[model samples]
Structures are given as structure tokens and as C-alpha cells.
Target: MRPFHYDKPATATDAVTNFRPGAQYFAGGTTMVDLMKLDVMKPARLIDISGLEKGRYDFIKWSGKSLRIGALTPMTKLADDDKVRARVPMLSDALWLAASPQIRNMARIGGNVLQRTRCPYFRDTSYEQCNKRKPGSGCAALDGGVTRHHAVLGTSDKCIATYPGDFAQALVALDAVVEILGEDGPRSLRFADLHVLPEARPDRETTLAPSDLIIAFSIEDADFPRSKYLKIRDRESYAYALASTASALRMDGNTIADVRLGLGGVATTPWRAREAEAALRGGPATEAQFARAADIAFAGASTTDENAFKVELGKRTMVRSLLETARMEG
Candidate 1:
């Protein structure tokens, strides 16, 4: 691993105060540490926020509309928690789908949601031409490219990196909000807005500033009756998805009254398939209807030679999620 300075702060303010000069705030040390070890991230300093008071971590307040979660809360804790499992089974399943039981025990909810891109070229820094790793340096993936797992949505000529986390997919589907604590103050933003698309600047990954720490994510309670996580990968377990869907539906007397659909592994970030959702909002959840929505979802997909099959794969995966959820309701 690359050599770096490490600091542990007792409070949020203390952490913010110490942030700057190309430092990265460490929570679970899962992704960031891995990147540092791989030399993908070479920060001047590492501010360890795990030392912050554990009492500050909470998931209790169901005040009016939203549910608040603490940043330091473990993914396993959240997964096994009765409240989360009962309310958001889709989110629960996504968490359960990640890593192993051991890793999930150590990984924080905040870190999982704030994880980095999984581009092979970016991770292997020996290439010396990653736009994300070294800004303005040409991207090797663009020239020596076989972009089977590269980004499809929100990509640019500069980069086509894929966001490689499962929890963010659930967050986008639920229309969740991520809380960021910075040197200035705390702020809230929609999860969809948190991740930056590589439209122009492929170097930027998120809306977070240098000093900001992801505090937690909040999801408003929606009365959508059924939700499901359908992830298709090369294996049965402990693998990242090639095409996945996080879908929720509310049925009104044999028709779809409402729907929430999010795509994973098929794009740059947690992509909300609003066009597909809008088409099937009040339509019957029949085979043709589900297929039609899947078509709409994949309509705007801009894929290349390597991953063109993802368009069809994404549609089939979405349709399967809908059909399976509909059967479960019956």
C-alpha cells in the first residue's frame, strides 16, 4: 500500500476541521483502503472518522415522513434489523447480496453507498493514463477498449466507468437522500444527484467536496406494496451483477397503480428507469406490459460492441423482476 498520513477524529466537527490538502475521510476503510492499496487513490492524508462517537449513529426517528440512518451503521446490522427488513425488503436483499457475511459485518452503510467506480483500467494504476486516477491524462479504456462492463448511461468520450455497488441501486430506487457533513455544514441531496455522470469531466465521481463525509442516507416511506431485487450475474452468489433490477409496484384491483424501477450493472450509476415506470404506472402487470416497460427502459441505452447484449439482458431482467413480484403477490 502507498504510504499516507492517518488521523482519527472524535467528532464530526473535528473531522471536518482536519480535512483538506488532498485528504480522504475513512469510515469503514473498505473501498478507500482497497484503492489505496492498489494505488488507485494516493491521498496525502487519511482522516479516520470511525473513531467518532458510536452513540451518534442512529436509525430511530420515524418523525413524519423520512427514516434516518447513521453513517457508521454496519450493512449487516441494517440487513438483519427488523425495521429495515420489514419495510424495505428490496434494500435488505441488496445488502444481503453484497460480499460475504464477514465483510458486511465490517462494512458501513455510508461507505457502501459512497463506494468508487470499478473500472479495471482505473484500478490498475500502472497503465499511467487513467482519466479518473490522473486527471486530463488520456483514458486507455477509450483506445485499448473492450468495454463489456463499462458504462452505458451518463458516459462521455473521456470515460465510461461503471459504479459498482448494490446499495446505491436500492437508494436510487427508493428515491433516497444522502446526508453529507462538510466543513461548512451538513447538507442533504437526492441519491440520484449524488453520483456525477461522466458527461464532460470523467474525473469527478460525485457531488461531494474534498472535506465532505457521508453521514447517512434517508428513505421516505412509500406505500408501494411490493418491491423486489433481481440481480443476474455469472454466479449464484457473492458476485457483482451484469444486469439487475430493483423494482417496486403497487397494485390496484389487478392493475399497476404505482411503480418504482431502478437499474444496476447496466449503466454508470444507479439508473432510475422513469420512462419505463411512467409507461407501466397504471397498466396491467401482464407479460406484454412488463416487456413494453422493459423496452422503454432500454430505449435510450447507448451501448458499444462489447456490451450491446446488456440492452436485451436488462430488458429481460426487468421483465423477470416484474413477473416474479407479480406471482409473489398472487
Candidate 2:
């Protein structure tokens, strides 16, 4: 951590009011602080927003038709909520299967979704060819660097780093909307549109403005009782995913009435397999259909020698998630 000014605003409006260029909002500091320590990110000032809007933003509201979660709500709080687990189990499972218990206890949902990629090339400053770290420089990972953990989908020539978060995948599958309060006031955007693919501008990861403060996430029709988040990794616990899927399925006997799929660990963003979901919808809930849907999901995948296996692994993960979700009690 280099020398920087710190400010803790009393309210959300106050926090946005004090925002300036090169200033970063600090909440859980789980991801930001880690980067700051590594000198990967050096904001001129840090505005602590964790204390702001505690009563308003640090909450979880579940209406029968919808659910709204405060941005400041801790990962553990929402994951352990009986209502969330019973109704939208995918959301709970994603959070539960994320970082260790200590991290979940303090990590807020807003920051979790906005967390930076864990690419070694981007994090370690010694590597001088990271487009995400320094735009126009180039990507070291694409040039024969260790890419076992890099992305296989939504990858551009400029960057192949994967979005390393579980909760965002769940939100994408559920079509959650993110509410934002910026210097220009408030607005809402579809969660699916929040993260842009790393095309030419690899440094620009999210669509959020520098001063925009995420207020909360809202989801309409939050009644996905038959849902699951399945993650495959090198280890069983406390590890980043290699290929993961968040699946929510509604079955009409043996036929799929509705389906939603969000893929993680194999993509540059929280990936919504809309094509896969379309193929599964109104189809028989069987391994053959599931495999076909999986094929459609990875049809546009671009892979490297080190990470090419992600295509097959990602497909298998999605198929397994759908199978597990379909087996859930109605």
C-alpha cells in the first residue's frame, strides 16, 4: 500500500459527492486491498463506503415475486439466509462455495461481483506485458506463458484472463439488475451488461464509471427452488474454479419448462449461456439433450494449448449442473 488519503463518508450520497478522478470506493477491501498491497492498483485516495448506508444497503429483502439485496450485504449473511437458501439455492450455494469462511464473513456482494481477475500476469508487476494491467502494452499470457487458469471463452487477442468469481455467475443466471449511484445521480443496469468483454481495451473491465457506487442488486421472479452451482477446481476447497456452472431449471414432468445457465472460470466475464438455455428449454431433461446444450454453449470458445481442456470441462460442468438441479425436489 502506497501512501494515500482515506475518507469514510456517512451516507451513500456523501460518498458519491466526494468522489474524484483516481479515487476508489472501499468496502470489504478484500480484493482492492490485496491489489493495492501488490501495487497493481494505486488509487490516489480511498473512500471507505462500508460504513455508508448500513441500514439501507446492508440488508436482504425477498418479496414473493422478487428479491433485492443490498450491495453492502456480507456474503455470509446472504448465503446463510434461510429464505435465500430455500428459494434461490443457486445464489446461496455460489456464495457458500466461494472463498473461505473468513473471507465470506467480510466480503460484500457488490465488491465480490466487481472483484478483479486473479491472473498472475496481471497481478505480478514484474510481468510488463499485461494489457489489463497496462493498456496497449500486450498480453503475456497469450504468448506462451502459463495459461492453465486463463479463459477459453469471450477472449480477445488483447486479453485472455478469466473473471474469477462465483457469485457473479449466479447473478448472471438469475438476470439480476445492479443499481448504481454515480456523480450524475442514480441508475440501474442489467447485471449481464455490467461486465464488458476484454476486447481492445483490456484495462476497462466493467461498465461502471470510476465514481459509480453500486447500491444493490435486484432480481425479478426469484423463485428458483430447483437450482445448483457446481464448481470444478484443482482442489475441493478454497480454490479458484477451472470450470463452473450455475443452473436453475423448472421442469414440467420430464420436459424442461425453463432453464438458465451461467458459466464461470472459463470465460472473460460472468457468462450467460443463453444459447444453451434455449436448447434445453422445452426439451426433455436427459443427458443427451444436456450434452447437446453444452456443445452449443462452447461453440464459440477460443482456447490455447494449456487451457483448451476448459471447453470440454466447461461443457461437462454445465451438463452436471443441469442434471443435479433437475433432480431437486419440487
Candidate 3:
């Protein structure tokens, strides 16, 4: 990694106060350090906030109706939580399937959700045509570059890099709220609104400002016992997903009373398939209905030559997740 100054703040207020235009918060450093070593991100200073407020940001609070998880909580803690595993298996499963055991042990939820894309053109400096890395430079993946892992659902002519996180998909599906501590003060917003589509500006990924620090994530209704996260990848383990779905259902006899759908590994952002959920709600919880909903989910997808198959793969992943979730005893 390039030489950079480091600072450890004792509290959130101090961290925010010390923040500068070229400073980055260091938590678990699983993602930031990797990018730094690769020279993909070169910050002037690293503000270490891992021990801020004497670990006040590391916690899990679950009520019968809602769940609040601190941003600094490690992935392994949340994934292994008894209540989270039993009541909200989708969230737990997403965390479990996100990375290896070592990575899970060190990665914080706040950093995981903000992890950058793994697109080859974006990660490697050799390519000069990554719009995400250098705006207006054009996208190399569009010009006969390998695009097997690129996005199809939210692709613009300027970029097709996919958002490669599993937990964020669950958060989007469950309508979780993200709490933030920024320069102005504390604020919260829908997790769905946290990430922005790469429309005209591929370099701009999230809606967060430079000094915004995520404090926690809250789910209003955490009783999704009939929820599941299904991921499809080139390999069985230690690989990024090609397409994945987070599905939750509320059944009323033979009909679907409520449905939630969030897609990952196939979109520009942690995708919430609101259109698909609308189609499945109040409909029969059958393969036929699920298949129809899946089709509606990818109806607006734009694909490249190598990533065209993702459209079909994404649909199948969604259908399977819905069917499997519907079969759950809870």
C-alpha cells in the first residue's frame, strides 16, 4: 500500500470532526486495505474508527417486531446469532454465504454494504476504459472484454459493473433503514435508497457523502421466518455470485399475502424487485406464479453478448428462491 497517515479517533463525533476531503474511515479494513494495496483507492489519510466510543457501535438489538444491528457488528456475530438464524434466516444466510470464515470474522456490516465492485476493468489500473474508476473514459467491458460477471438489469451504455454484495440484497428486500452520522448530524434513510443506479455517472455508486458514517441498520419487521437467500455461482464455494435472490413470503392459506424480492449479482445496485413482488402478492404460491413473477423482474434488463445469459439465470434464481421460501414450515 502507498504511504498514508493514520488517525484513531475515540468517538464518532471526533471521527466526523477530523474527517477531511481525502480521508477514509478504516473499520475492519477488509475492503479498503485491499483496494489500497491494489492502488485502486489512494487516500491521503486513514481514520481508524474501529474502537470508537468504546465499542458502542458494535451490538445487536432485537425486539419482537424489529431488529437493530450496529454498523460495526462483525458479520460472523450476526450470522451466528440464534434469533437471527431462526427468525430471519435470509439475513443470516446472506452473511454466511458472503465470504470465507476469516473474512466474515473481520468484516463489518457497514463496510460490507459499501464494498466496491469486483469488475476487472475497474479493479485493474491497466484498463483505461473503466467509467467507474475514471468517468468519461468509456467502458472496456462493452468492447469485447470479458463480461461474464457484469450486470444486465441496470446497465447503462456507460457501465455494466454489478453490485457484488449478498447482505445488501437482504436489507433491500426487507426494507431496512440505514442510520448515518454525518457532518450535519445523525440521519437515516431507506436501505433501498443507499445505492444509486449507474445512469450517467458510473463513478458515483452510493448516495453517501464523504464524511457520512453508517451507525446502524434497522428492520421494522424481523419476523420473516419464511424467507431465503439463494445464490448461484460458477463454483460451489469461495466465489462471487453470478445471480442471487432474497425472497420472503407471507402466506394466507394457498395464496401469497405478502412478498419481498431483492436481487444481487445481476444488477447495478442491491436490487429490490418491487414489480416482481407486486405480481406475486395475492397470487398463488406456485411454480407457475413464481416463474411469471421472475419474468416480470427481469423484463427491463439490458444485457451484453457475454452477460445475456444472466437475464435467464436471474429469473430462474428468483423463481427457485420464491418456491423454496414458500415451502418453509414457518
- The lDDT for every candidate, in the order shown, is 0.81, 0.94, 0.93
For candidate 3, list the clashing residue pairs, or say none: none
Off by over 4 Å in 2: none
Q: For residues 208-230, could you state the per-residue lDDT of candidate 3 as single tens digits?
A: 99999999999999889999999
Total clashing pairs in model 1: 0
TM-score of 1: 0.95
Q: How does residue 323 of candidate 1 score in lDDT?
A: 89
lDDT of 3: 0.93
Error of 1 at 197 (Å): 0.5
TM-score of each: 0.95, 0.99, 0.99
The candidate, 2 or 3, that scores higher on lDDT is 2
Better of 1 and 2 by lDDT: 2
Cα RMSD for candidates in order:
1.7, 0.7, 0.8
Predicted model with the maximum lDDT: 2
TM-score, cand. 3 vs. native: 0.99
